[model samples]
Target: MDIKAVQSSYARWAPVYDKTFGAITNVGRRCAVEYINSRGGSVLEVGVGTGLSLEQYKPDMHVTGIDFSAEMLQKARDKVQALELSQVEELRKMDARTLDFPDNHFDTIAAMHVLSVVPEPEKVMAEIARVCKPGGKVVITNHFERKQGVIASLERLFAPFANTIGWHSDFEIETVLQEDALTLEEQRALPPLGMMTFLVLGKSGG
Candidate 1:
């Protein structure tokens, strides 16, 4: 998906996101947040759409979020204000392909149901690896293309319509695992018929 398409698609979805896509992705979101909270520290959440998982973080955990869509960020900011979520340190408009933070800035980084939606996911993954602290965790939850089955066929069928659908149905997991500095620690199938996957990648260090 191109960046413009992503921005426009999310602008359209922002209004009903929490009740629609957000609800469907709830299981994976909760799972990621719970895992991060257990190892609380400074967190950087990529594609923090609507901040649905904001309040779930432990109060002691400092979180910073970024998104390319202004429409979506507004919703997130509103949630932070209305709920008085002090753990949310800041929310900025930023491109994942070029993160603004310094090297090894965050103890944890989260990308939830977002990689497929962003353009050049490989670049985004590299940026993620760059800013994550050594030995820190990068938690991800996303729908990857099925290898074989009825779903695989459907994925291929919709591959061309990524710009319209707002995400790539045939996105591969290898796209995220290419960063050598990040080692895969765990991988598992998530709920809703296992269409989504949960991954934990630990940055290498002492």
Candidate 2:
């Protein structure tokens, strides 16, 4: 996926994002946050669109969120300020592929519903692995393209519309696994006919 394409698509979607895309992604976000809350540490949330999941985090946990879309980030910022969400350490307007944070910064990093929308997803994964503390966990929630069946065919057909849709319908699981620093710890399927996947990856060392 291209960065500009992602940006433009999000810009258009930003107005109705909460009622639309945000609702659809709620299940994965909830599951990811519940798991993170149990771990309870410094967290970095990549692609924190509209801050829909911000209020659900534990009040004591420090959460830093980053998103590539300025418009989307603005909505997130508004939510934080309006709700006085002190748990949100920051809501940054930044790119995922080249995170500005120092290496090994966050104790737990999350990439919920974001991997498929980013350009050079491998680079984004590398950044996630880099800023994550060794032995830390990275939680990911996204729709991975299926291998067969009618859904797979539809995904392939919609592959060309990624630029317009803002995410890859045919995104593969392997794209985000290229970062060698992380090892898959667990995997599971989420709601709505199990279209979305939840993956728990651990940074290789302590």
Candidate 3:
């Protein structure tokens, strides 16, 4: 995938991103935040689009987010500033494939719906793993292209185009995490979007 093109496209769509995909279950957002909050320490959020997950995070928790698009970060900045969380939250424009943080620096790391858009999803996830503490968690969710069938066939046909516009690959959740040695702790499947799956994974430091 073209990173610049993806960034530009998201720059244009950042304004309406939340309202559109936001139509999906707020449950996922809430669950992600609560899970991170429960850890009670510094958090790193990759691809923090429009701050939809902010509503669920506690203001006391230290949170830092990074994204590839300054335009998207702009929308998120307003909310962080509005909530007086500027002290606790630092938003930076960055590429997920190469994170700037040191090893084992975060208590929790999240990449909600982020794996799909990057050119190298596995590399990004590995980077997420590298920054996370030995036992830290990585929360991820994406609408997958269902298993071999008519729907899957159709998705495969249009995948190249869909991918260009920031849609997900047909990757199975398990496959992505396997290379990083992360253990899945929970899973949630979105209704109607059978391909959509949410997972909470723990780094084994193995």
Candidate 4:
């Protein structure tokens, strides 16, 4: 999906996101953050829609969230205020492909359920790698195209409507593996029948 398509689709999703997609994605988010908290440090959540994971972050870790959708970000901002989550440093509206942070800025960067939805995911990966500290890690949770199954057939069927749905059902794991600075460290399957995958990539020398 293009930028406008993502923005519009998320605008519609923002209102009910914490109850809908947020609920469905809760497992992956929890797993990612739990791992992150174990390795505690400054964090950047790329597509932090509605800030569902904000309150879960350990208080010792500094967290900053960014998203392209203003509506989604507003909800996230509201959550931060409501919960008084001091761990959250900020919530900014920024495009994934062009991040505003300096090089090697964050200790960990988490992109939960967002790689397939953004435009130019490789560019997003590049930026993620660029901003990540040399010894830091990046966490990704997403659904990739299944090779064969009833779900694989459904994913293919829904492939053409990516823009409308806001995520490519046929999106591949390799698309987010473009950053040379990052090395794949771990991979695993998530709950709800393993429909999603959790990935961990450590920057070279991290």
Q: Please, what is the whole-model Cα lDDT of each candidate in the order they appear?
A: 0.96, 0.94, 0.77, 0.93
| Residue range 118-173, candidate 4, lDDT tens digits | 99999999999999999999999999999999999999999999999889999999
Count of clashes, each model: 0, 0, 1, 1
Models 1 onward score TM values of 0.98, 0.98, 0.89, 0.98
Evaluated at residue 140, the lDDT of candidate 1 is 99
What lDDT score is found at residue 182 in candidate 4? Answer: 88
1 against 3, candidate with superior lDDT = 1
Error of 4 at 62 (Å): 0.4
RMSD of each: 0.7, 0.8, 2.2, 0.8
Q: Judged by lDDT against the true structure, how good is candidate 4?
A: 0.93
Could you give candidate 2's per-residue lDDT for residues 101-180 as a string of tens digits? 99999989999999999999989999999999998999999999999999999999999999999999999999887688
Mark the regions of model 4 whose C-alpha exceeds 4 Å error after superposition. none
Determine which window of 10 residues in candidate 3 has minimal summed lDDT: 162-171
Stretches of candidate 2 exceeding 4 Å from the true structure: none
Number of the top lDDT candidate: 1
lDDT over C-alpha atoms for residue 13 of model 3? 79
Cα deviation at 169, candidate 1, in Å, is 0.4
* Alpha-carbon deviation at 81 in model 2, angstroms: 1.1
Over the full model, what C-alpha lDDT does candidate 3 score relative to the true structure?
0.77
lDDT of 3 by residue, 1-206 (tens): 67877887787778888878765746566667777888788899898878778657786788889989888889888887787664346889899999999999998888777777776877888898889898888887676667788878877777768535676556556556675457788887855555567788898863
